[model samples]
Target: MFDKAFQRVNTFEDFRTELVEGKENRAGEELIQESRKKQKVDDDKETTELKQCLEIIPDEEEVTIDAIPLAVKSPRIVDWKIHKEGTKSYYQIIRADRKSQMYMIFSHMLKSFEREHLEDLYKLVKARYGSTRPVESMDYLLWNDMKIMFELHVEDEVWKLQQGYKVLEWKLYDSCGVHSLMMQSMQIYMLVEKKYPLTPPTLSMMLERSFKLIMKVKWLISCVN
Candidate 1:
């Protein structure tokens, strides 16, 4: 092939002269063809790599509470009882009998507290929301109960601190209050349970509100204690 790339010389002297004239033409078009073939192979390899990259995809996994087995996921649920209050149906949780006595004691304490301070709490709520409307409902009762619980928690924490307990070192931080943090967490949990199909804006608002409430409660508890 290389020999065909050039014309044949007549004699040895002529061949030597041709060699001298074609010194710059060693390998001739064969080298150019080989280079083009190599370039094409390299371009094809690069194209294959680009196609593989374009075809690559990432795998994603989604998880939901319903996807998990009930027995294994939530073993604490003993039973549920439905109570019809007028038109609304409320589900009452009934846990193990081992907790029956404790539940009874807690209920008794709540009833006693309400009995003693119901009038006072009513007055406070009335002052907060004007005396034009009467506050005599579940929300009023819950608000008073939460306040009592908050006070009790704060007092207990203060006593613990006085006794040289290092509990507050971690519990009473700048951003969170130990007294009402649990209640706020429970509120958030309940909110999530009641509002599962929440929009991004709603979820964001709830989180911001909950965080501010928690921080405010913590600051108030610290000031009072």
Candidate 2:
């Protein structure tokens, strides 16, 4: 009789142990599932933000060089030479077409620095325009931004020159002329670089190219970071 009593007690204790272990295992599984769901939600949010940040207008029409009207009087052949002023070196292309008129300036610098400058410009645009695409009228704003960027580049070049450092790969150009003539000259300059020798592009085209370049730089930076 005592042996039977002891065996019944032992069976009850074993059953309790098994029940406790089963509950613990279920709790652990629930925690793991919850963690996986949270992780997936976080990932989805990041992807959505990235997509919004990189949004671009589709099939936007561009004004080609051929569309621009030629100047009534051909511009005088301007002389270009490397100029050094107070630790800054740049190509100075004088516009002899008009006396005392603004001439074109070209500076060569490191491609990496150029990319960073473009990224900075992208940030400025995003801050002003948010996720909305800029309108045609807003092209002037972009041009202004580019002008500021070039000015900053000039300062940077001066600093680098002072440090006895010289870099090259990317070219920066600034000029003033009749809109059509300016566009033509710019297009010619770009084409000459590529050895294609084609026509010039409009102000809008130049802005569009700058926008695309900024986008590319931003995308590359995101990948690296």
Candidate 3:
């Protein structure tokens, strides 16, 4: 191949020579052909590599993905129950988010505290909501009737689908006095059940650990007594 290229080259030596040199005139014609073959092989190899590079590149469609729909991942149940108490309701929580797995977790958390403290918890939350008292302690539950009520409990179907939501009431006692000291009446309401994360679940998690410790001590004292 080199011999042919040399032949192809119109060098100064070619002008000096009377006759055109044939491509196979030199003894190195075999080596030149081999070199040309190697050059062709290299160019073919480069083309193959370029094709492979183009093949490996992703398409515009492959670079993009479809958007996913946001799903409700919370695990809370709505326990709608009717208000059995007969008093002018002061505060009412109306939650009707059709997308929620249940009603908002806040009511349930408050209800958990209510269930744990029963009327006491309810009054406690009510008191805290109504007044600005620093929550120190809870009396849990303290009644014999709660067991029966607990069995038929369902807050989900409590009130009808009214045009507007109703409010909760503050009940009065037999002494003609509005039940002021709710926790003081440790014989009526009791704390039996609870849910987590009312307003701040993370904060609830911390409180849960602390309450667990307190309950453990209470258990130890009861066992000893």
Q: What CA RMSD would candidate 3 show?
A: 19.4
- Report the lDDT tens digits of candidate 3 across residue range 1-225: 998888768553654353435533563687888899999999999999999888554565456447664543222222222222353212222223432222222223343232222344234344434434333221112111233223323232211221122222222232211121111222112122433112243234435655777899999999999
lDDT of 2 by residue, 31-116 (tens): 99999999999999999999989955567766445554565433443343345567554533333463322222322211212333
Candidate 1 lDDT (Cα, whole model)?
0.40
Error of 1 at 94 (Å): 35
Q: How well does candidate 3 score on lDDT at residue 183?
A: 18
The list of candidate 1 runs beyond 4 A from truth reads 1-13, 20-26, 56-225
Find the candidate with the highest lDDT and give its number: 2
Q: TM-score winner between 2 and 3, please give it.
A: 2
Q: What is the lDDT of residue 91 in candidate 3?
A: 25
- On the 0 to 100 scale, the lDDT of residue 5 in model 2 is 94
Per-residue CA lDDT of model 1 for 164-211, tens digit only, reads 221111122111111121221132111111222333544455466668
**What residue pairs clash in candidate 2, if any at all?**
187-200
lDDT for model 3, on a 0 to 1 scale? Answer: 0.36
Q: Is candidate 1 or candidate 3 better by TM-score?
A: 1
* lDDT for residue 206 in candidate 2, whole number 0-100: 51
